[model samples]
Target: MPELPDVEGFRGVMQRCAGGRRVDGVEVRDAGVLRGVTARRLCRELQGRRFAQPWRHGKWLVTPSDGPALVWHFGMTGELLCAAPDDAVEAHDRLLITLDGGRQLRYRDRRKLQGVRLAADEAAVERILADLGPDARGLDLSRFLRLLSGRRGGIKSALTDQSLLAGLGNLLADEILWRARVRPDRSVRGLDDDELRRVHAAMGRVLRSSVRAGRVPARRGWLTGRRDDAEPVCPRCGRPLASGRTAGRRTVWCEHCQR
Candidate 1:
């Protein structure tokens, strides 16, 4: 699944390929990936409008134009790609927006799971984001602690819950917890202040590195790199890693490291 870092990478793609560019055409090769708007309405609303600066919040990417804003939620298999108009469209290229120049922006998705939404204005965009909690990347230590303080669940569950803290997915949650030496099934309330602070700092570090790499890097020293190994072990310690489900998502942690 495309998580926060992946979505941020797509935001960079949007800014580079379509920012401030005039829309020459809108093509909906597969309408199954659209939400709350029909193919005809999408073309009508965005055909001639110029795209403004694109931004991202949590896992959502927003491309604002003269009228409505295009909101993208890349579910499990969705991604945005930049290509030349003459380039061949891939099997999953569901939507394409041709810019004024030679570039074309493609919305490609294999699962077609959460797709696109057309927000009529800034207010509409807010309505779409209202359900989400504060973005994880922008949270400070104080706010991060506060957000976790009120939630009652396993630490991993709180971390991955969009209503509690947006942007973290299964991989990030596991990685952050591992770095903090906190177990996936540890209760939020059971953690001491020091543990919470460690979690907050770990989140910041993980996000910074992931954003720079444009994805959660599977570096040799990182848990993400070894999670799928034949017999995964902790990078910090040689003990074997353990796996289970938390918050309905697969979670991996080091029992010897995380307490």
Candidate 2:
């Protein structure tokens, strides 16, 4: 699945390929990926309009045109591609937007799990996004602490909850917890201030490095690199990592390093 860093990378794709470009045409290769709006409505609303700025909230990306905003959520296997107009459309090229520069911006998804939608304005955009909590990259220590102070779920659950904080997926949740020396199964409400502070700091550190690298880096020094290995061990302590499910997502953590 495409997480925050992956979406951020797609936002960069939007910036370089679609920003400042006028919509010459909207081609729905496979309408299966669209939500609510039809191909005709999408073309009527977006064709001829220019994409001024692209924005992202949580896992959603907003491409503001003269009228409706194009929202994208890269479900399990969604991606944005820049290709030539005559370039052979891949098997998963669900939608293609022809830009003014003769290049095409494609919405590609293998499973068609999630893709594109059209929002009328900023308020409409907010309505679709209101359920998401504070973006993880922008969260502060005070707010992070307050949100986790009274949660009853496991620490991993609280970390991955979109209502508590957005953008963290299973891997990030496990990575952050392990780095902070907090157990994944611990109840959130029972954590001490020290643990919460460590979590906050860990989030910042992880996000900064991931953003810089354009993905959740699976470095040898980090648990992410080794969790799926045949003989996975914590880079920090050389202790073996364990696997289970938390918040309904498969999880991996270093028992010795994380509490």
Candidate 3:
């Protein structure tokens, strides 16, 4: 899944590849990936307009122009790629945009679970965005503590809950809890003040570091690194990492390190 850091990286790609230059053309290769705006309307609305700086919230990326904005949600296997005109097309390139300056941007997704939406105005933008909680990268410790104080779900589940705090996915939730020394099964409200402090600090550190790296690095010394091994071992404690299911996704944790 393309998470916050991944979306942020794509935002950077949009800035470099499509910003400033007028949208000479927009080819909705697969109308299945577009929402609210038809192919003709998309081309008409964006064809002559220039793309501005893009913003992201949670896993959603917004590219605004003078008219309706293009909002993208990269589902489980989606990505935005920038390439030259003659570059070979990947099999799943669903939406392609051509700028007047000759560069091209392509949105590729194998499973088109969620795609694009066209928000007509700032008000419409707010309608779609109003429900998202504070972004994880800029989360405030005091506010996060307050939110956690009344939750009954497990720590990992709470972290992955987009309504509580946006931008965290399965890998990040597990990694953060592992670093905080909290078991995935531990209820959110069960955290003591010290434990909450540790969790807050750990989440901040993990999110910042991963966003800097442009993804959950899955590197040595982190749970993400060893979670997929045939017989995964804990990178933090050298103990065998356990795997099961939680929050309808595969869960990874080190029993030795996490309480």
Candidate 4:
């Protein structure tokens, strides 16, 4: 799934590829990937407009134009690629935007679970994103604790809840919990102040590293690197890792390392 780090990378791509450049045209290869706007309207609204500085909230990417703003939510398999005009299109290339400098931006997704939305103005954009909580990357420790307070769900579920802390997905939740030495099934209400602080600190470290890598990198020595092994073991303790569903997502944790 495309998480916060992945979306941040996409924001970088948009800034480098099409920032301040006028959009020449929009070609909707698959209209099914568009939301709240038709192919013709999308093309009409975006054509000849320049893309201003892009923004990202949680997993959403926003590219503001002179008129309607282009918002994208990359679902499980979605990605935005900057390609040459003559670059071969892949099977799932859904939307193509031609830029003034002959560069092209492509929205590709295999699942098409989420796609593009054209917001009429800044208010519309805010309305669209209203359901999301404070972005995890910018959330303060105080706010983080407050958000977790009174919540009765498992720690992993709370971490992955978009309404509470946006941008955390299955892999991120597991990785953060592993780093914090907190069990996935641990209840938030049962955590002490020290444990909460530890989890908050771990979240900061993990997000910074993951954003730099443009994804939750599966490097050796990291929990993510070992989670998929045939017989997964803890990177720190070498104990067999536990695997089960938490918050409706496959969660991996070290029983010994994470209490």
Candidate 5:
């Protein structure tokens, strides 16, 4: 699934490929990928308008124009691609927006689980995102502590809860907890102030590097890099890594290190 870092990367693609360019045309090859708006209305609303700066929050990408704004949620296997006019279309290219200069922005998703929405105004946009909590990338330590204090569950559940702290998925939650030296199954209320701070700091560090890399980098010495090995071991302590379910998602952690 595309997470926060991946969505941030897609936001950059939108900015580079379509920002400030007039929309020459809109094509919805698969109307099922659209949310709330029909194909005819989408083309009518966006055909001639110029796209403004694109932004992202909690895995959702938005591109506003003079009229309705385009919002995207890249469920499990979705991506936005920038291509030339002559480029061959892929099997999952559901939507295409032709730009003024013949550059194209394509929405491709194999699952088509979540796709696009057309928000009529800023209020509509807010309504669409009202259920999400603070974005993980921009969360400050003070707010982070407060949010954690109010939640009750295993630490992993709190971290991955979109309504509690948006943008973290299974992979990120596991990676952050591993770095913080906190067990995934540890109760949220069981953590002390020092542990909470460490988790917050670790989240910051992980998100910074992940966003820069445009994905969770599976680099050596990082837990993410070793989590999928045949017999995965902790990159830090060289101990065999443990795996199970936390928050109903697959979880990996170093028992010795995290304990």
Candidate 6:
């Protein structure tokens, strides 16, 4: 699954490969990966335009052009790749934008759960983002606490709720809870100020490191690295890890470390 960090990486790819380059052509190999726009219209709209600055909010990537902005959401198995014109076409390559100077930007997805959207203008782009809460990276501690202050669901559920706080997925929610030493099933209404502060700080730390790594890096010292072990144990305390489903998502936590 592509989360905030992975999408951020994709934004980097867009910047490096297509920024300031004129779009020579738009090839829609699979129209199923497009939303709200026909293949012919997409090609017509973007054929002569140039990509300006690229932006990312949560797991969504937006590339600004002279006309409509190109927005993308990489679902379960989607990625944006930059390749030479002569490179072999990938099996799952759904959309291809040929740029000037012989470079091509490819949108590839295996599951095709969520795909591309063409926003008519800046207002349309804002409309697309209207349903999402403040991005996790830009959310301040005060607002973060306020968002969770009176929430009714479990902590994990609250963290993973896109409407409440966008960009956190299952791995991120579990990792943040583990680092905060809070159980995933604990209710937000029952949490104390110290616990909230711990969670806020952990979110910042995890997002920073994960964005730099371009994913939720599974290191030996992190819970993510040990969760799938034969008999998972806490990396911090060496206690057995507990596994269960929270908010309908698989969750893992350290029994001793996260109380």
Q: Judged by lDDT relative to the true structure, which candidate is superior, 1 or 3? A: 1
On the 0 to 100 scale, the lDDT of residue 78 in model 3 is 81
Error in Å for residue 131 of model 3: 1.6
Candidate 2 residue lDDT tens string, 68-112: 899999987999988999999999899999999898999999998
Q: Evaluate residue 170 in candidate 3 and report its C-alpha lDDT on the 0 to 100 scale.
A: 89
Task: Assess candidate 2 and give its TM-score to the true structure.
Answer: 0.96
Estimated TM-score for each candidate:
0.98, 0.96, 0.96, 0.98, 0.97, 0.97
- Tens-place lDDT digits, model 3, residues 1-259: 5888888888888888987777877888788888777998888888788788888999888999866788989987788888887898877899899888789999999989889888888788878878888888877888988778778878888888888888899888888888999888888778789888888998999988888888888798888888888989988678898888988889998889988
* Per-residue lDDT of candidate 5, residues 1-259 (tens digit): 5889989999999999999999998889999899999999999999899999999989899899877899999998999999997899988999999999889999999999999999999999999999999899979999999898867779998998898878998888888999999999999999999899999999999999999998888997898899889999999999899999878988999999995
Flag the better candidate by TM-score, 2 or 3. 3
Tens digit per residue, CA lDDT, model 4, 42-123: 9998999999999999999999988889999999999999999899999899999999988999999999999999998999
lDDT of 5 at 166: 85
Question: What are the Cα lDDT values of the candidates?
Answer: 0.93, 0.87, 0.85, 0.93, 0.92, 0.93
Clashes of each: 0, 0, 0, 0, 0, 0
Please provide, for model 6 over 154-248, each residue's C-alpha lDDT reduced to its tens digit, 9 standing for 90 to 100. 99999988888889999999999999999999999999999999999999999999999998889979999998899989999998999999999
Which of the two, 1 or 2, has more TM-score? 1
Residue pairs whose backbone atoms clash in candidate 4: none
- Tell me the TM-score of model 5: 0.97
Question: For model 5, where is the 10-residue window of minimal lDDT?
Answer: 145-154
